[model samples]
Target: MRLIKTGFCSLVTAGSICGCTGPSAEKPASEKYNVLIFTVDDMRDYAGFLNGYAGKVYTPNMDRLAAQGVAFTNAHVTATVSCPSRNAFLTGLRPSTSGLYNNGQWWKAALPDIVTMPQYFKNNGYYSAGAGKVFHHTPGNNPPCSWDEFQDQVFDDPWYFQDWSPEKYWLDFGYRDPKVPMPDWKPLNGIPKIGNNDWGAIPGKEEKDYGDVQIVNFARDFLAKDHDKPFFLAMGTYRPHVPLHVPQKYFDMYPLDSIVLPVIKEDDLDDVPAEGKKLAMEGNNVFVKIKEYGKYKDALQAYLACITFADAQLGAVLDLLEKSKYADNTIVVFWSDHGWHHGTKQHWAKQTLWEECTRIPFIIKIPGAKYSDNICTRPVDMVNVFPTLVSLCGLPSMEGLDGHDMTPLLENPQAKWEYPAITEIKVGNVAVRTENWRYIHYFDGTEELYDKTTDPNDWYNLAGDEKYRDIIESHKKWIPASFAKPVPSKEKYYFDPGTYTYMDRKTGVMIDGRK
Candidate 1:
């Protein structure tokens, strides 16, 4: 692991060769930083730094990384969808301890031991990498010992695309076209006229023919090279997740008669809970056919023009990480593997448990974090981004982690958490959320709650209000006591992909998909 390459006069005279300091000093507790995660797909809390959409959504590089730092505003996601919320925050663990509740299961066929979060930053030395759509791209669901390099998930796709017309040919890639019509052309009454749930404005694709602009131009050429270890990179963009296609100047920056939609409430499921109205009118309810075909302001102006074309590819990867050379020791972060539901509880996407599919848009920053714009508001989780990047990069604390140490909410954004985030989506379904309550429960026992400081869009349910029954038994003591058993899905296993292993579709053997 001796790759070396130091600079800026060996980071200002390597104080005893490792406690180096220079680029504006202060980092030297044996130096190692550089992480930068940035994931975004199916983003929610419609960023202008999480105002969760009141309308005009532009994002300015996630509001300049939430004004450079802390911004948690009660983040969440233990699993809401997107491969069980990115396999429960890259295996900090919880789809009921990795049974992986859907996007066709396969967290290495249900926890192949489990290390992940870039294989624990490539088992400590760090130089991980990664690119578009981080995991759950299927065929073996990513994992090659969790990246020392990764990058080609077809670089996320769409360099060029067209063809869905012969009566929308079953929306192509997912097969289906046998003379169409089996619930094919719906056009908007809850919207699913076929796959990737259609949206428009792709006239002449540009912003470098996106696939998140080749995953932010491979994270701006891996932050302009010259690094020797201390990297981890990870970009993963895949726009507002779906055919919300972009470019027409981000669909002329969301026009369709000035878009705004989402207020719903045709009695917002009346007092909700028959398992939250069977997950808001059940099976593909697509906001009750996008409020019965008015196209809910043309699918909310194609999801705010694919979220301002994924925030101009996250302002061209944060303007190449503030013009590279690991911009004063990188840590960055910016999240979003969950939280979407475009029509609030009438639901639209992200396998609901709610708070618009588990809140999201987390944001971190760190590089010399003594706290900047800091927000926090308590209730954390995203499996506390794997033990808060192993206690902010000092490393080494990995035994059965179920998330904690968010470095005291990134150095006190009013820290004192007491845990409430939770989430899940199946197997005894959950939810939780806190910092003013949300609860939920489902899986037949049925419940719901919501108070969130006087119902911030959770629209009041108070779970049979017997004075909130000790706040629903204290958020049901944080759910998951035991669940696990679900696995067999990358279509019943098989895998191999050059021996990354897996097989077992009824014991045809193989299994060992690494740890």
Candidate 2:
């Protein structure tokens, strides 16, 4: 296996493989460094350099990941939904491969052979510690399985005990409006009384408290703990997700007049096939009808505020690391489970093939890696998290993994990379993204194609536009190798017949999970 190196004098001509041929080619430079993976629940590539974002949202901590490491503008997770998207990342398997398609499902039933990324870290002499939402709904239940110790920074589950503090509580407890929420609210509570306490971030000040502080507080303490050897810390943050909750301070960071919603022409859904239109209209089941630009802007602003809070929280972790003995030797990898969609084609949240939904923000900062302040637009799938780290850490690349080693791109930022990544939604919908093209295969034998080069907004679907069939054919060249695994019955991914996920581990399978 060869790795790519930046600034190398060698070049590849018309027909040659310009690969590993330097002293750095021996093994991964990050082998012995401690690992810290900072994952935001739902975020976009709006950090700093990704540039096309429409907000005043600036992530200095996220910028650190990109400036000091590699920022992947073209990275994507398999699903936009939480549970499945995360299962794919941790298991090194696609949602299709792992049989994790919806938040309504569990991974253990269909894919018990899987070992989570942290589990892999724990297997080898690392003291793994995790805080917050690492594996979606599993939340606090993540068991110190992969981690030596785990704690939920927020309330027990999705709702927190501190809900009464934020304004969102007034909405759930005050105004129960689902479709339309008030555009205005007061941030009377301001900051939490406990400086290092863990709480959840609900959209406005009322739903859930800002959870970033809670998660990062536990994470920083873990980093400062006495360690006999290297440690692996996983910090999961649920922000920029929905019911968007953040402190009034973060919300104030971006004024309403300063917000800009995506441009959607009246004919935006014209090219979309009937089925794609159906799904888009359903908005991944979370939303039914499309809200006007004004409503979405407010919604998106809340999400962005959560991101801002998340950014500052990330700084806390980085601050503790810079002060710790392991500062220079630890490797930090930051990513979001999946990208989000805020009224693009009338969709919000995850579960769409659009770039806004599938593309995740990935940043890797190895202690002494060759790349820095580099933006690799090369397409990378969520599955690659497995093989990339394994190779970089000098661990044998796992056998039968879905992703390839990304070591080369880290070095040769603009190398002739492979084709686009392939992601699956349900069994029938498949999306492929090459450098400038995005193609989707829908469930009703319908296909949606967009010439990303010409249609950045994906306003025009080119699937049936016979004139562009060649470009569509080109994207098809990299159809993922299909496996013949039988689809598990929907019953398989559901909670065990008599089990309550909230109960103690010893009481694992008995409450029917019918709450």
Candidate 3:
């Protein structure tokens, strides 16, 4: 199987190819390298370089970064959802190990002692600062111990942040006042507004005022100043996620007429198992509604526009870093929480174990690594991120991490790696992805097998075929024998943010999770 390099040269005909062919820019040696991580929300592999989408994506900044860094071409997330995925990667623990299978459970309330990546860095004498939706976008999730200074996310959309009562929490599902000016094109494609499901250019909203832009501005300000010690700066972009509201200019980038819908077969779910079929039907049900309205192309255009807008925010910070004092010594890690689906396999949105949901564009830029502008085809997941950073920065080895250090692959893209990337949706539901195959096993003994080499769309499930028994066995070894019991949801405990204690809502008994 040939892997395409979605570098600037391959995507655009007129771009310079010098960055792809030359060595990375030389930087002076430093005692401790600063860390700069950009986490984008609901972004799939739709970079101009990754080509995750069938339509032409305009992401010059992502392409440029790929050309200057080592792009992990076959990277997958530990979990498919935002909360579990971020928790698994940041905490260096898989959902199976942490028992955090969904968005309702707060990690701080469930497992307080777990040292997150930022907290680990802060513990190791590094100054930590962050802004925007790094965690689950909940107020209580971002504890003070993780950072010396942090900025909360602020949205330009008027519908959001209008009310903030304890009952409403940070993200209230209730509707706002009818007088407020919401996106005129909401329920875009006439589909139901299931969980902020809308996208378009919000009139009178400037690009600079967008929530993601404000987050990047904070990072840029931090970059502009010289810190007393090496800093760990993390910035998150909330575009291309939901209510895909951006400036008019980004929407203009992808005209509705030029948008190409994802290629999906009518009978894609026929061969899937009961569990797989259930997940596919959930996605297909949404797609069916989208198709009934005859607005699939319009929806794609809005999603594509959001992706480009997010890319622009990414470019802004990258540009500032290049011009800043820490350009040489800072390590840049760009990743999305999970991938989004645009009518792939007759499915819409993420949460499925399929490629569109689990696969992501992961790039790590070590200033003076032996290899740059290279592609690593080995299967790696977000779980390796924490330990890999620890190894790269020469920090002491952390005990009890589920992932292995990926330093060898960073040093050499073709290094021998035996571990396959594993992604989980809930307890006992897992997807094991490798270079040539993806095997999924569900809690009820249902299974799905796809040969990535032949069928990238996973249109065919070969799990029922006896010929692939050995292949299934090989992938099955990677699955956990037992999963940890799920922790109680936030409703079970009344959390005191000041004390970081969880009290039983019914019993009124206080329990300190940090202990």
User: What's the lDDT for candidate 3?
Assistant: 0.79
Span of 10 residues, lowest total lDDT, candidate 3: 14-23
lDDT accuracy of residue 243 in candidate 3:
73
Summarize candidate 2's per-residue lDDT along 48-93 as a digit string, tens digits. Answer: 6676576566688888768777778888777767777787788788
122-168: candidate 1 lDDT, tens digit per residue: 87788888887877665677867888786766532322122323444
Candidate 3 lDDT over residue span 380-463, tens digit each: 999998877776665556778888777666656777789999999978899999999999999998999999999998888999
The better-scoring model by TM-score among 1 and 2 is 2
At residue 91, candidate 1 shows an lDDT of 79
CA shift of 82, model 1, Å: 19
**What is the overall TM-score of model 3 with all chains considered together?**
0.89
- The positional error of residue 1 in candidate 1, measured at the CA in angstroms, is 29
380 Cα displacement, candidate 1 (Å): 4.4
The better candidate by TM-score, 2 or 3, is 3
**Stretches of candidate 2 above 4 Å error?**
1-31, 139-143, 156-209, 284-294, 370-373, 480-515
Q: Quote the lDDT for 442 in model 2.
A: 72
> With candidate 1 superimposed using the best TM-score fit, by how many Å does residue 141's alpha carbon deviate from the native?
35
Task: Look at candidate 3 and give me any clashing residue pairs.
Answer: 6-49
